[model samples]
Target: MASKGEVHVVHLYPLQMSIYGDLGNTRTVTARLARHGYTPVLHRHHPGDPFPEKAHLVLGGGGQDSGQARVQDDLAVIAGRLRELADAGTPMLMICGMYQLFGNAFVTVDGDHLPGVGILDVTTHANAKRMVGPVVLTTDFGEVVGYENHSGATRLGAGQAAFGRVRSGCGNNGDDGSEGARTGNVFGSYLHGPILPANHALADALLSYAVPLATGRPFEPAALDDAIADQARTRQIRRLVG
Candidate 1:
């Protein structure tokens, strides 16, 4: 989406929703902007409020089950706005709970099914075997690291996706696969730890979509710090086992 001058990023339901290091998603975007000599304007929205449309990027992160249910109720009120933004191609990055809500529906443990935002052609089923620990994803972009913790089975059928296979542990749909998903300009996934500080390439990819719209200039790639790169590798190794 073309920008209205400044790059605006909105963090939805941060105070009430979000799990893992989901907030790190926001941090990744803002920090990258700061490094590029731009001050990113961040906003937060909750239930009973209207989401502003002047956003270049929208970020939603992971959260707990009960929190997810609560936010689902609130998100319904602004579902139209979210759809509008997606339709306009404003890039979005959504994590666990956010991913779940954007899907077809979520089946809870007690046999109750809840409708979602219907953005992704997928469904989540509660499972007894909890998914936890570090995850290693081998993508065309390269390896990325993040933690996984969930109790559900996610199934995707012939839709947009972010990863190929679960190189290490359970991923997006809780089926021991995927790091996340990509549909249009929206990227949803289960990569925890906010998925940027360590995955600089991802941060760059996301910013490449938003910054050009905001500044009317093409994105230029840069190298990650050697120390940071080493740390990220170490983290990946740890995730391989931890």
Candidate 2:
């Protein structure tokens, strides 16, 4: 396969916030990029490390409370740059803990406050009862599937567009039918089955947005054989939803 172009993916705090196979989201991107004939250049952005100035896509994962604390300060340091990238339409996928951190604040069960980047118009509070289950959602990309394991109940600000509607399972706060938050190309969600492998459409959407921005070229996604992946997703969704 001929190389198309390069997509610069920035993995934010991979060490601190990669729980429940969230790091697979980043791996999925690289694999899909290879399938799409794009050069995948991955950069891991750890705490106290320099963030890449030119990033096409930003990915982050969930973490425990301790992990969140570890990256809190570094996240603050890059908050301004992140905001700039977000406003400029860089595609970002922030899952679980990262999702909470992208919001206004995350209030722990003990009432300790962790400030967020304020990118997404949402707030999260830790709940004693954790929501853990396989999830099925109805998104603009079509029916999406994943697994959720979170104690944080996130509430979106009024009029904020959600990533999807919950078809099954507890999402966002488990009070609203909404599941995730979205602004521009930035996406926040509690879904974790590593997310992307089970929901390739969402990954494709992210890549489509990323390619043009990163390479300064028109994006024409190639048709790839996704029959196996599609079947797996169908089975999982059927098992979970039916």
Candidate 3:
């Protein structure tokens, strides 16, 4: 994996809509990379603009239902390019709303089925209660802490998961089995906190996936302090779940 200094992380579709602290995910990712003395170029992409090429890492954040609807068309326009990049091994991390949109289609509350990018074999439907709370995810990489806030029910397809058992909270797929959707190096999750601040392990995995292409060296993940924030965030989640 390339060192952080050599990697470029782009925020896909940040302008029109942003849900939860999705933007925070971008900040967290860049911050972690910076700690290793790697300067990550964070690029924000919007609708109708040309996506940068051969990016090491790509990020997609959550947004409101209406915003999702509004962006669907724009996303469709660049869907081919995005898929091509993913197929070519460019790592992508998509959250909640963006995660669902990567599927074949989304069944909105109004019974409207909107077209999706179809990069993954998955489907999402609106649920009654908006799932909102902290989540504990366990994966081959390691455990991750983040929040889930959405009314979408996701069903994993043939595609792999970014992580194993979600362990806690109602994830986007409405199941507790996995953290998010993944295809090749692409990852999709409902951890609205952008999943970087508290989940160093997952962040490293993402970096690992991208940096290899940018630089030939293996990734050297920096240590993160989980103890400092554990009590506060865990207590809040425990209270919410209870």
Candidate 4:
């Protein structure tokens, strides 16, 4: 357990996974926490490691197909603990391959089914062609932009709340307008480019959940200057729209 004023963050599979610049997401979380005066104590977990005793926030990132396969068995071992954390309102941000593995299962193009943690009520089908490009989403937090590169087409189960509606680019699938899935404090998205840097509101929202959980009281983080991030987001949006 974290001491008061400190947040325990679990970074899962940082070594075997995180093929796509996904490790940057962990940096963003820590930076945001620092700006808000909370000390973020990171617990990095690799395959075969014991699950952390407590975590106010958990982060898992995208990986290549091979990387995904490498961590599947290890992930399954901790699936029950993850589900319990989600149910208990711990905040999580799972990206790309991790997002797929958070669901019921991910069916590969070769017709093999990779068992998932089943934290999200969704299923992913690996397609031959990848969906790679900038994506815009109109989420409850507002507009968010990021880059996506994945071949998994995920379909949400009944009663699943999408993280947002697609504003541009291929989302969960080229067909569905949904871009990601969210249940309580758990967020699963395909967006990369180290998602939080461009999506300040979403970052703050995650912090809002974590701070309260860590400190046992509500917290409203002080605003920080996001000028550079906002400028980059605008340029990306323009390029995607134009």
* TM-score to native of every candidate shown: 0.88, 0.97, 0.86, 0.96
Expressed as tens digits, the lDDT of each residue in 197-230 for candidate 3 is: 6666677778877777777677766776667556
Using TM-score, rank the candidates from best to worst: 2, 4, 1, 3
Q: Give the alpha carbon lDDT tens digit for every residue of 96-190 in model 2.
A: 99999999999999999999999999999999889999899999899998999999999999888999999889999888899989999999999
lDDT of 1 by residue, 135-241 (tens): 78776557777777878677775755765467888786555456666677787777787577778777777888887877777765445454775587677767575
lDDT agreement with native, every candidate: 0.75, 0.93, 0.76, 0.90
Residue pairs with clashing backbones, model 4: none
Local lDDT at 84 for model 4? 91
Best by lDDT: 2
Scanning candidate 2 in windows of ten residues, the lowest lDDT window is 214-223
Query: How far out, in Å, is residue 53 in model 4?
Result: 0.8
Greater-TM-score candidate between 3 and 4: 4
Point out where model 4 deviates above 4 Å. 1-4
* Count of clashes, each model: 2, 0, 5, 0
Model 2: CA > 4 A from native: none
Q: Please give the lDDT score for candidate 2.
A: 0.93
Q: Model 2 misses residue 161 by how many Å? A: 1.1
Q: Which of the two, 1 or 3, has more TM-score?
A: 1
